[model samples]
Target: MESTGIQRLFYILWAIIKLNLYILVFTLAGGIVLGMGPAFQSANDVLLTSGMDYQNITFGKMAERFKANFKRSNGIFWIFAALLGIVAYNLFLASQIKGLLWFILSFVLFFAILLLLVVYLYAVQYETTYDISIGNLLKLAFISVFLNFGTFLKVLFGVISILVVTWFFKGLLLFATFSLFLVWSGYATKNIRQLVEGKLG
Candidate 1:
């Protein structure tokens, strides 16, 4: 049992390393700025579809997925970028102000960012899983966050845990961080996705 558990850990680590390499290579292939979206979508696709079945994860498959998702992934990326920019500007404005209004605005904007974060995470996963319009995808992801608030919290916790660990062991940022987060996001959202599917059916 102990040796089996160790082997499982090794396999998980190896998979994450390979995923990290794939994301890095593809992101650079698009010159980082252009590559970020498609690369992320491709990685998310593998995580959702393959789960722990890392044997089937190949660079060619990732490339194919990245090419297929390029346009739609970029659309999602730019939209979220715009929204995040707006919120960031608001945050900057809040920083310049003083008094109760500033406090309230900051508080509201904090949750707004969180809402956007949850929606963005779900949006990326749903894009790969469903063939829905981006407009409807955003709406569904937004609604799902509230409806599946527990899942949101679980994902949030996983993210925080990873971030905290990465803070102490910064080497993870080099490779494992994003891939680990993707793994957690895939696991955290699985049940909520099933529930949504059941309701739709």
Candidate 2:
């Protein structure tokens, strides 16, 4: 049992490493700005399809998935990126103010950022797993975040934990941080996706 467990652990680690490398290479292939969106989309698709087992992961598969959704992925990526930029700019402006108004604005802006992050997380998964139009995909993903608030909290905690671990290790940022994040997000949001699907159907 101990040997089997150790082997499983090794296998997962190796898979994550390979995934990280795939994401990096593909992201650069699209020239970073263009590459990033498809890279993440492909990663999520590959991970979900494989049931997180990562045993069937390959460069060819990643490339195929990346090319499959190249344009759509970039559209989704830019839409959220613009929203994030606006919120971040507001956050920076809020930091310049003082007293209670600053506190209030800061709180609201931060929450908005969180909500956006949650929606983006769900958006990627939804796009990968379903055939919904981009408009509805974003709308449903935004709504699902609130409907599945408990799961959202779990995802939030998992993200923080991963960030904390990576902060200390540093190297994990390059090697496993994103792959691990995609794994956690996929697992955490599985039920939420099912619930959303059932309701929509």
Best TM-score among the predictions, by candidate number? 2
| Model 1 CA deviation exceeding 4 Å by range | none
Candidate 1, 67-135: lDDT as tens digits: 999988999988998998899889888978999989899989877887787788888878878898999
| Reference-based lDDT, residue 137, model 2 | 89
lDDT of each: 0.86, 0.88
lDDT of 2 by residue, 54-88 (tens): 67888889999999989999999999999999998
Error of 2 at 137 (Å): 0.5
Q: Give Cα distance to truth, residue 47, candidate 1, Å.
A: 1.7
Off by over 4 Å in 2: none
TM-score for each model: 0.94, 0.96
The 10-residue segment of model 1 with minimum total lDDT is 48-57
